[model samples]
Target: MTSLKNVQSKSSKSCYVIFCCCTFIFAPLLIGSIIYQSSGIKIPTILSSINATFSVENLIDSPTKIIATIPHIPLESFICDKINISRFPVSSTTQTNDSFDVYRKNVLEKYCDIVPVPRYNWSSPKSYTENDIAFVIFTAAAFFHTRTTAARDTWVSRITNYYFLSATPYPYLPITVVPGAGEDKLSNMKKLFYGLQIIYKQQMNLSPDKQQKWFYIAGCDTFILPHHLLKRLHGLDYRQPIRVGGHWGQHDCPGPNGTKFQAEFPSGGAGFFFSMKLLEILQPHLTNYVENVWPRNSEISDVALSCLSHQLGVPLTKQVGFWAHPPAFTLGENGRDKFHKEPEPNDFHYIKPDEMHALDEFYIYQHMDRLINDRNWSEFTQFMRRFVASHYELLRKKRRECTLPTIEAEVKLSNK
Candidate 1:
């Protein structure tokens, strides 16, 4: 009996030790998980802490580590990609007198006169050297075959990692048709929030190298100078929270103090650029806190986005590049709103299809004229973005008195 008692005592002590070790090892993780789950705000990762604490130098090897080699679910396995909460609260001001069917019908009917873009070869690429950038092309299905087509043909065609979130799916376009994203035409707040959410989920991981660090979000009508934009992002760390756009000092966005005076953000049409870390911090709040407190009153998508970033502690950082309006020779001031009174536009917003094609030429030939004629690549402006520019413009000068987006051109182009 004494011998049995001794053995049982030893067993009890061994069990106690094992239990303590487990608590020490997993207690923090459990606590952190609980906090994240409950608040849906701060997510604690163990990749080094959540991803394995890798060095910046180490990211060079796998710069796209966000998409795990083995995803939680297979990419092709997706039949539907709805968020946790599919619709806004019925009491919210986003509710409309017109049902979604009516809204979508109006959208389609409005753009029905436009021709559908030819299907792109999804398997191959447009041959430009891929960069660590992911594009969020916020589009409506109405513009899918027109404006988006123009963009895809020019610069977007060259980049393979672009995303299109449409109100309804275009069977031919490689896009995700989100449910509530477009139902409320009151504002583009839902669309913008879901867009970033989708992007964040697509590359959620601890591996910094496996994720595209820089994200650019713009409307389908916006024209992008990817090569020029890349220069802007050079040497910027992906881990830092960076937001760059037209620093329109507007205080109409939502604030942490339940007001719109907290944040000043960039123009949505011209587009905005952000780093990965800022996105990660904002990911959790998109579905929960954001939707709940979004403006029922006067809310602009760009303002709301900027305000949210400010609330999350990120401020707008701008440099010389954005063209808030479409390109006009006399539009920008040298050291003021743009680089040099020149239309050295990094992103041109509120443009039409013809202007997109024309602007493509305007930028392309200016470089070709320089390279073949002057042969000077200095100040980094010479190449035609040669490989990226359209072959149709190679022999022609489409920039001279061509169709522009100055209100009238869009009307004329639409009639044709």
Candidate 2:
């Protein structure tokens, strides 16, 4: 009876030992397999070293480190891939005003990917006088009171000769605004034609030796670096009827069945340069040209001018440094309002009214001097690149924070 009792005790002990060994060996594998199946993440086979470096709690709290451990994965792609959001539907109702607003918002959101930042190679400041170039500035009567004022207070003073091209009277600049045919695209073209007429008349009135070599046209919002522009112009022959400006590649026209057209015109925002010879060639045909190419409401003045250049068989030279979009520094409200307002020894002083019009004007007022005087163009370029990168980073962070909610709301609205 004693021997049988001892055998039963030994058998029970052996069973207990087997159960302990199985739990110790198989529990971790089971847990890891469950995690892998659910989350599509492979659990590391060896955890002892990993645990020594990063605690499980720390890894849970900071998933960014875990994401970093993954190779060649962008944070945006990771987050966006993880979140399942429905796309906003496009229907016939998308043509409505409210839907158009949403469409425009969507388009603007994609600008970071579409539009490229402008870059220019720096040249040594050349010895060219103000008399070498004349400026024709385009503005509307609506914007004249504000945009025109901002322009005059800034870079306009740096040049000797500049004419305001508008239908309205601007006596503050003391130059009569040249009247266009009317305020429409065709009218704006006529205004430019009229401006050319005026410049031609002035040139005809002057002695041949005293005539200017280059004619420049810019919008009120454009910031001109006179020294840099003059340096660029100096390299080209004033004797030839050359057209110089930034060029855009093939882009779709603004219509439902928009066809792509190759545009080699300078961006009007960055401004364009016409040699005196080219202006002279254009003078004789200005009236007829304006009458024939009567601007369609959808036609852009710059593109039209480029087309005209092609028709005239003039060469279009692509130069850099012209910016179509405002710089990153002049993005926010504070940057637009009070940038470079602090008085400096050599700075141009102007009383910026309580009401301001364009941010580009303020940006020019702030950085014109620095850009003109940049002895180290490479350094300036690097600084600008860094500034733009930082701006985009912050913008990306903001977009990421709000993307989920915005997308969800849009999805709900679409469903309704």
Candidate 3:
């Protein structure tokens, strides 16, 4: 009886040991699985901080890093091959009205009748070289002010409608006028193509040389030309294959504060060169932006591109100019109430027709026998001649210095 009781006790001990071993082996796995499930639950990434920390450089250089770091968001995409850019000069003050439209139409008719050949020794380039270029003009209401106001001597035209046409005239010239549309109509990103298509039709008129090197010029109050523009952004060799319009300055553009006033760049109105490219890209998406969806009121299309850049992870090659003090406007003092004329040691202050001395005026009259009706063209050509005559040596020297990248190299890099 004692032996049987001892054996029962041993059997009970064996069962207890087996249970202990099982608990030790399985406990870690159960706890580990609970911890693993908790870890699998994700916390969303904060974006505004990422935007502030990462810069335009990171976006340009290594976009993937930023893509991984930021939260995923839906982006509107359109296949765009061209970019529409517009230029507004800072001097003119003509508003859009019926009478002004008539005047502009007349200018266009006259411009189309003439050929924009190599007008000046320097105004026309020999060939649209390795870095080919084009211009897209945005005619705002102000450029319609054709008269020579004050001694500023802005907007003079010379119409020789009879004595032109050595070659087939570029059809959209004398003046290429863009019909005005309300900003509300333009704000839709999808429908921007209609305006682009219209521009493309006009550009078809340029000479093959001018066509290859197409550049758009607008009749607005705050335009920046391509020469100064390319210099300001990247070294002239940089591929400005893409750009878009946004806010710029305040003199002609009426706004409390805009990209124009910001001191540091990557802000400011899209200048003339950009308009050409914008037209090219937005045409495909124009129907979408303009027709279906409405444009955002505060967000100008040009400014919207910057936001788009962030969304797409595409880096802007250069930052637009921003203003801190009074803006750098082309129109002389009389054009603006806020304008101040400080001593500009760097500028070549050319003498206007009125500024000339009696002897100088007499000489000009003797030399200027050619008859041209448009004061804007006459004065501008005269200024160009004077500028060239005074600084031709300097300009020629600078031309030699303006080195551009080879097209083959650029193409190779782009492919990579």
Candidate 4:
């Protein structure tokens, strides 16, 4: 009887220990998630905070730090929220003469009508307009005449506050030189970080009337449709901390210390966005993060920022329609038309100079709604499929390109 009593006591003690361990290990995470999801307030994760602070012992213990750092952002704001192209929704009785214009004139020219601009009764007193969005475009000396020019001529004009940055500046062009940014493997990454810093500083100095509510960060190689982009932003709550993009996945950055740090980030080429509230949170941390964290960063600005954001508990909310590559390369992969069959895309990356012009003109002349008349669009669709086949290899990259193979995306944010 004594032996049986001892066994029962031991089993009960073991169970108690196991339960304690589990509660200790998981309770904070569960609580943190619940609070964050419910309130949209980012609670700086204790573990992530500790990891970053100690990542560089040199700074943590040193009294003379590189710069004064803002320890944390108050959990005041957090909010959250891409592209594909389709053909023929609106038609103009008078369409510009292009190769495709000939096709439209022969078939659906008479049916083409200008789409009426949408008017919204906004809940906020201030509605989002072209002035409300600022664009920060990454470019290089090599692309100044080609990609940059194409972008300027096409969509870059809508917003008054647009910046083109490069490591090597061409005074003749709109591109500005980033201090200490080099034209190396990590050039684009450097540009990304420095560009944000520029936006934060420049926007903060602007008068209230000129301040931007949203910021779009993209490469010069990307072709963006301002109309569609604004449409997407219109539905979002700009007052909250919002980070929206297409490319998102975990990436590993191996430091000189031989440790591999991982972060989930959006790809830079297709473009990403930040709400004004997010920019304010990030602005105070940029100097500290660049000084302390850049050394251990993935050397990709997007991934590096993702790591910093992870520490600060910022989430990358994903959206569809940010096409990774031009239609020619991606059209037939998931069965031709399967991708375009979806909603009209906002942007396309990995496009050539001519391709940018072609796409810009297409969207300008051809209407984007597939629901207009299936019969008319079907013929145009078949023609585009043949065009895709004939021009399969529009531009070839000497180095392997960093592109998301699919347009598939997801919202990885808290419930709010």
TM-score (C-alpha, index-matched) for candidate 2: 0.49
lDDT of 2 at 35: 66
Task: Give residue 336's lDDT in candidate 2 (0 to 100).
Answer: 31
> Taking the tens digit of each residue's C-alpha lDDT, what string does model 4 give over 1-416?
44777767665665565565556545776676677668653433322211111111222222221222222212210110001111344345755544343544443232112111111111221357666888888887777767887776656643456888887766544566787767665676667777788767887798876788888888888988765666666567777888888756888753446667676777777787888888878777776666665763345676777776666677888876676677655564544455655345668889888767766655643332221212356645644664454233222221223354687688688886
Give all candidates' CA lDDT scores. 0.59, 0.54, 0.31, 0.60
User: For model 1, how does the per-residue alpha-carbon lDDT over 36-144 read when each residue is reduced to its tens digit?
Assistant: 5675433122222222221222212222212112111111101011122223344455667454333334332222122111111112112222468888887777787
Off by over 4 Å in 2: 1-124, 184-186, 250-263, 329-416
Model 3 lDDT per residue over 197-274, tens place: 655665567664444333322212222223223333333322234442222321221223343222211333233334
**Residue 250 lDDT in candidate 3:** 19
Selected candidate, larger lDDT, 2 vs 3: 2
List ranges where model 1 is wrong by over 4 Å: 1-130, 205-208, 256-260, 297-299, 329-343, 371-416
lDDT of 4 at 122: 15
Residue 208 lDDT, candidate 4, scale 0-100: 74
Candidate whose lDDT is highest: 4
lDDT of 4: 0.60
